[model samples]
Target: MQDLTLVMAQLDPLVGDIPGNAERAIETVREARIEHKADIVVLPELFLTGYPPEDLLLRASMEARLEAARQRMADKVARDVMVIVGYPGRRDGGYYNLAGVLYNGDWLGEYAKQVLPNYQVFDERRYFTPGNRPLVIEHRGARLGVLICEDLWEGRPVHQAREAGADILVTLNASPYHQNKPAERLALFAERAREVQRPLVYVNQIGGQDELVFDGGSLVVDAQGELCVRAPHWQVGLMPVGFTHADGHWVPQAGECEPLAEAEDSLYCALVTGLRDYVNKSGFKGVVLGLSGGIDSALSLAIAVDALGPDRVQAVMMPYHYTADISQEDAAEQARMLGVNYEVMPIVSMVEACNETLAESFAGTPQDTTEENLQSRCRGVLLMAISNKKGLMVLTTGNKSEMAVGYATLYGDMVGGYNALKDVYKTWVYRLAKWRNTQDPVIPERVISRPPSAELAANQQDSDSLPHYDTLDAILERYIEDDMSAEAIIAAGFSEEEVYRVVRLVDRSEYKRRQAPVGVRVTSRGFGRDRRYPIVNGWQPGE
Candidate 1:
């Protein structure tokens, strides 16, 4: 039996930082060769240009720069170990997302990704032409196949590699995280391994890019569809997978398999990872948010502190006339407990100034939600001003439930560079607050248990204008996430009146959602990329 050691470099690459990323990849390759003494090193998808790259892929200069970096890497790579690297390939007036083999200081072969995912956070169809064939290489007495992220998911590339006599598969991925995505991926990997009957090494990138977080749960699966090695999620490191050649096929040696975190832990980790990367990668000195004592803002403060630590997070309680003593006290208590830079900026004066300015125009109009929204706007101004002056990113605290409806004030509470709970439902906000406290009681118990309110007007609870959170979230899950119609939702045991009201609110709020700050997406469908609805569409459900 032949023994081969493979190094999986689970790294976090900044998007569009070609030279920096290239240097990092080269160092990782050298480490795999010199330290691990590995026969092969596999990097994540688009390691050179970073995953998604977005509009940067449109630049011809980016391709040229990447090619130059590739040659620089080729000159430095040792002949004893082979490196499989992912880069953007430009040939014959077409761009292809590619993975190439570098060995003996030369390019062995390149495999263009066959599947260009277009759904949910992926828009590769807008850029590259899908590859038609799979590329497998003969290396060190072993037949190895290379597949990019989406290629493995489509199954054709893996099957094609198997047909081409590949004994072992190494797939590079920059897969983004959602709750329980690791479990789903492992299940899919097991199925794919059984189909190909070859040991597969899966290498994924770890870090947050904008609203997306890639959890690096890199692993190896045996031909029998059993997981052999699993790296820790949300971590960046070099993990080793050993393969032994037996009966003309490679079998993976058993190794470490980190236990999957529970639902709450995984979701919280995703939030923290996504927030941390966005703040750090974007070069923000720190983060600032208006911490109302409500669950949404309170939970957001906890997440920001956890992500960036106390010194990097600023919590400002902008209280108004309607803001209760309990709200101020709880906000202060949580801020003190978490050790964040806390301040109290009462918005009463700001609100009064705005109200006075609008008094002439609103003389005939009676007080409504508009007056209440001004309070939120006052807080928004203070938070954004601090963000601008201190070079700290403003963290919007609105949750998915409020954002789904028109409950949040646009340019008011919605003002922020990022939202930690953008995809989290209101009910989940309470649950997360409670869960976070279990780690440590930073969040006040009253903050989690109190009836949620905006405190914008007198006795203005969330239920004053909308249905209870339990009913609202359930209806929203069916409508927004599951794509169920209002009639169908009502059939799912919801009241007909509540169903239509929630659906209408969700429909009308599309414009607001479009302008809302991007946040960590813990659910399958988030407001940002996963679900796209036309703001002016007249199509109503069950019409």
Candidate 2:
């Protein structure tokens, strides 16, 4: 039998852009044929409409658009190079996630996705009907088995495909990025390859869609469970793998094995890719954010600069009476180092105006958090005004730890179009800042060394109202990400008072988080679509 070459097309597709995605796939097929001599080229899952098309799958024109796109690909794709692409299609009078094969201007058999993931960031069951059978096609001296994203995660799909007389398996994925997800995927695919005793080729999409970022770390594992090819994360390209039928088994040839990045580096890249795609895809001219010289804003500014470059980012420092001189200095210094447009807009007058306006309403009430919140509101107003006037989106700088405990002000500091650090915890924020500085000494050392504060009032520190971030983030991970109850968290060696207090804050802050702008999701349990909770609930903090 002759040898065969397969190219994994790890490309980004804009959601709802059917024609554009089809054109991209055609071009990728042509490139794979001419550049890599690929006999078959595989695109990622939902390449026609992009992954998680959500309610777009329910549109009246969905089927018509998909058929038109399929015809377009058939006309433009290379005739000799076989193409395996994923799209949402109608079969047996039901909408299903499908992988269709096209070769030599003719339609080959298609495989409907069997396993529909309905957890965390996925809602596939809401739109697609699951397929019950497996599909295996004979092509280029090898029998090929096909699967979709979630199919490979389950045991039955892989086993069924192998049992259907397949020598090679290919799976298209739009799998998203979370912490340590790449490593986990590698381990899982290796085990699957060993179980099926067939070479496995995994193709994944790369881009940011809404809050989800798909890191394209595509992989290929040999029949013996050894990795042969690993496409670099956060990249878009055609990765090739060669195979030959030997001893009744298709043996994959070793190819490029790009090393996985460390946790900090990978997290940093995910943030940059997510922010860049979000801004560019949304057609924003640029981004404007308040630079408070705190760790959150410092890290956020650095990420913005890295994502959109200095010319596309603007930093505004709005200082009040309580604002420290060092805060202003650090903000200005970092902006200067990053070569971004920096401006200082004092909100003292704005705060004084608001205080005068509210004086009559607060005649008998003593001054409290209400007065402190005015400063943040004034800053938010200035930032929003600048964003509107300059045609730039405002990027909020609050981190996950703050958002989890209601430490942020609603419609005040939280006013923005996006938040880069929303899913990132406070502890990770510091680590990202430190890691970024290693790439370049832009963030001031004092910014990393000093204690965190809102600077909204005299001697204001985050610790004044909440526990230390180290303890707070730990409890929050258990309560929010791990779903540990108050009692469980306390049993995990945390103080009972701190556990209950943190849990209460998280539960109470759901309304605020619901109103906050969408942001990048780097964790498994980001506040947006990943976790759903009732705004008005009777559930208490205890188990």
Candidate 3:
């Protein structure tokens, strides 16, 4: 029987680091060949410059950089192994996403990605011209068909490869993470494998890129649509799968099949990976956030600690008159438990000083949210100062539910460089907190059970200005993610008043969200990139 060992290089490449990525590709090929006896190695889509290079693809030097990277790969990689890598190529004066095959220090063949995804965090069409041909190459008595990330999503590409006498289909991907995304990919690819009647090898990248996180769940399915191999998620490594040609078909040998993480576990890991990569890649000394002892901050602290370690995370509790004694106690207890540097800096004097300065301007104004917001602003100023002095990124702790209704103070509690829970709803915050406790028990029990409050004003609870989190999140998800109209949400058992109110608030809060720092996106439809609303518009809440 003819045998082939294929290795999937599930690696993380920093965006725009062409030379470094090329070196990494060369090293991975060498390692695969020496360790796994791999005859063929495949990397993720756009592995040279990382996925979603965005405007970097438009630079004049992009072609030169890519060519340099290609040359380096060719010169350094061993000829005994074949490497299939993804990079942007210019043909006919237009760019195309291409997967090039290299063997014996020469080009074997290349396949241009036929499909370009343009929706929901993908704008490939903006930079790439669609390709029209299929590429299938013969190696070691087996015909290998190559496809890129979006090409496998469509049908014509796979059909063309099969029609071209291909024995196995191989796909390179830089797919991002969202709730249940791994499952969605498996089901879709399993159907594709069965339709084409070929064993499919799928390779995906891992790590965080800006707001996107690519979970490296590289996998393989046999001709009958059976999963035979799966690499671990939220990890970077090289996975090997051996295939033998028998009975006129290439059959994949069983390999490591890592179990998929559960819902809460996956979501929590995504948050941690996103935060860790963002901090390390952005060159920050550490992260510091105002830990108000509420569920949101408590969970944010836990995530930061888990991501960058307690040594790299600092917590500052800025309490005011409205801040309760229990809040301070919980905050301190959690910080101590996590072994992070914790400090308490009261904000009462700072708020009074701000009021004294604005006394003349507010002489006729009755006490309102404006004064309560001052307390938040003072805490923000202190956090930013600490961040600037210590080179730490200020982590904002506002959840999606609060951000949807404008409950978060702009330039106040919203002051930060990154937010770990910006896309997570207030309800999920509690769920994640409880789930994390099962893992390590760092968050205090009272922190998870207590009613969430801003503590900006005396006797003020979040419920005072908004619906309960369960009701609020349900309405928000329907309107924001599902794109349901206000009338439709009302018809779905929500009260008409609450629907209209929440819808209006979401619409008017576009400006605040625009200014908010980018954060890890766990849901299919997050506030960034995916949801784009005009800050100045006359859109009303209606059907």
Candidate 4:
């Protein structure tokens, strides 16, 4: 029977843990062969050293470590099942991202990734020398062509593989998650599969790597562009895919297809996964955040509790003189409902002391955002102190909308190791809060309904400093995400004045965003790695 059973091992690999990841891959492949009768096992791209190892790839010991891993795998791995594993290889006076096949305790062949993606969160070109040729290997009457993540996305690699007489294609990916990315990926994969006219197996890594969360929606597609099997998203598992060769073509057998999560659900899961992996992988004791009784903080608090659970999360309400009674009440209520350690550390005295100490320096100046920033900075100091004392990571609660408009106080509200809502817009913050409530009513309703405020001054709403969130988010999506000009935004029906104002704010705030804490990226254009801009650019849109 010309039937091949491929086991897609969608896994989470910690960066720099070469021996551990090798052991895990070996054991998993062994189990697949013995238990599931898998003919071959496939792991995601750069699984050994982990994807985008960054500067770790430049270390002197990396090649030696990889050589050791290769020797160990060759020694311990059984000969029953063929395994395709990805790792970084140093050859020909350069380093290449490679996928090699190991079978019968022998390294059969290897393929270096051709297209090195350098945009957005990816910087593969900086570290890897792109391979010029396609690699096709034969195993048990099957011609399997190997392609790494970016290789499959570009047309040449797949067409070249087909020309190299490949019967089936196997791709390894460390593709990161952004909102609606899975759907977009599927559409692209289907197009590629149809274009190449070959059955393909796509395996992706699952879990978070700092800001990038890889949702494991590994799948199989037939030559006709039909999706045959889909592994669960944001999950780590080995999904089996069977393919049979008929007359002259390979076709994937019909199998399980997991339904995609809804928009809010997927984004929430990405946040939870990103936060969970960032804390757990970094070896943090837990997480602590100042939970203001507002939508952003409330959503962040809920995500923290969900990511690390109640015992591992601590919510502190740092109230000032201007902080409303309702804000405190809602904050405490949400913390109690979530069953986390809650505290109220009023910053009135801290602010007063700072003012008194700086009175002489600021004697001639009238009170402005400096005083407001002082309040935020006090809260930041307390949060950092608690984090240091307890050895827990501080979780900042600023959203993308605030980060885009220079609304968040740098070294103040932006003081944290991670921000769960960093890529989420303020408008989506409310939607996510409501969605979280559907799962469990941990967030107070009052918090979601209340108009957002920094509570730095009397009756100071977010609208006092910026446009309404709905308007601000819309303009930001167009200007920042879509790269629309101010004139284009005006043409799209937004007021010219508001468009110019929002555009200017987003442009000027690049410096602060450059220093802000890394957060989960749920949008296509997150502040950190996704959107990069110079701090001193003189170009103005519609000028």
Computed on alpha carbons, the lDDT of every model, listed in order, comes to 0.88, 0.93, 0.93, 0.91
- Per-model clash counts, in order, read 0, 0, 0, 0
Q: Candidate 1: misplaced stretches above 4 Å?
A: none
TM-scores for all candidates: the values are: 0.98, 0.99, 0.99, 0.98
Cα lDDT tens digits, model 1, 58-124, are: 8869878988899888888777788998888887777899998998888989999999999987899
Encode model 2's per-residue lDDT on 185-298: one tens digit a residue: 999999999998888999999989999999999989998889999999999998999997878888989999999999999999999999999999999998999999899999
TM-score of candidate 2 versus the correct structure, residues matched by position: 0.99
- How far out, in Å, is residue 339 in model 2? 0.4
lDDT of 4 at 478: 92
Flag regions of model 2 displaced more than 4 Å. none
What is candidate 3's CA lDDT for residue 110? 81
The sequence of per-residue lDDT tens digits that candidate 4 reaches over residues 183-243 is 9999989999999899888999999888889999999989988999999998888899988
lDDT (Cα) of model 4 = 0.91
* Residue pairs in collision within model 3: none
Clashing pairs in 4: none
Give the Cα-based TM-score of candidate 3 against the true structure. Answer: 0.99
- Model 3 regions lying over 4 Å from their true place: none
